[model samples]
Target: MEYRPYKPVNLTAAGRDYAVAMVRRHRLLETFLVTTLGYSWDQVHDEADRLEHAASQTLIERIDALLGHPDRDPHGDPIPTVEGHTHRPAHAIRLADAAPDIYRIARVSDADPARLNRFSGHGLRPGQTVRVGEREAGELTISLPGNDQAPLVLAPEETKAIWVSPAASAGLRGPASI
Candidate 1:
């Protein structure tokens, strides 16, 4: 968990609570901006980061209610509850690490907007069921559910930014389209 070399930090109970609160605020704001204010998935993260610092608990709760208590944000990240409990699927794995099988995208890293835009262009957003194919030279082959075109090859950086869970539990057995 160390982002810096030779630096280690652990969370105390209160510290954990604070961390969750900040995350909760961030995700809730992202949900609101996308679902209500018409922000694209690629546009909400930094906006949410800024808003999370200024939004009050009451405002976040109201946003949560307004969004009908969304379970996940535009990036497919689990939104923590007001109680600070979050549920990330146990089977969720980075796309690069996924076995060759059908999987529903669960989340994508929000660290880069350019990557997000590229993923969206390739139909790689959360809830999209994709088939993982061969791997070679740090790239993964991916195919959309019903596409007949050549498989899309995701580079290592893209795969590392994407996560997926098995498709059966996606609750999208008969999606209208991919």
Candidate 2:
């Protein structure tokens, strides 16, 4: 038999269903590990990647139920539903290109673990309010909402990896709220 690489489009209905199931399991596990176990967002991906293939469907469902069937993973990526539906935000834009204003960190791509660690160290995470500052020389400045701490300067890649949505009101100066 000639060996061929599998492509997403070539999956049969059953294959697609199984793939989605695995994805849902992986993402749910990632969320559970981070929120319930105190694992950092960047740390859960590898663990989930290892466990997802080994966990049974029953085990995955139990984990999902225990986590209240979370909609988003630790990194703010949407989890595919058992029915294969996803709820991605339509207005999410790259932090680098976002207009200077108040915005909520919607999602941070977990493609780079190092960048993820840096973001977490700077207290940047999903749902946090931030004030977008000036963009210059391929870097973007952002300040925590209402915090006196110095604004964090992020490289274009760093900023681009983050997604944001308009925040009702976030300012460079004000009281900080988690």
lDDT of each: 0.87, 0.83
Q: What TM-score does candidate 2 reach?
A: 0.85
**Global local distance difference test of model 1:** 0.87
Show model 1 residue runs off by greater than 4 Å: 1-7, 168-178
Tens digits of per-residue lDDT, candidate 1, 103-138, equal 899999999999999888888888889988889998
lDDT of 2 by residue, 81-161 (tens): 878999987778889789887788889999989889989998889888888889889888889855688899988889889
Candidate 2 at 2: error in angstroms? 14
Worst 10 residues of 2 by lDDT: 169-178
TM-score of each: 0.88, 0.85
RMSD of each: 3.5, 4.0
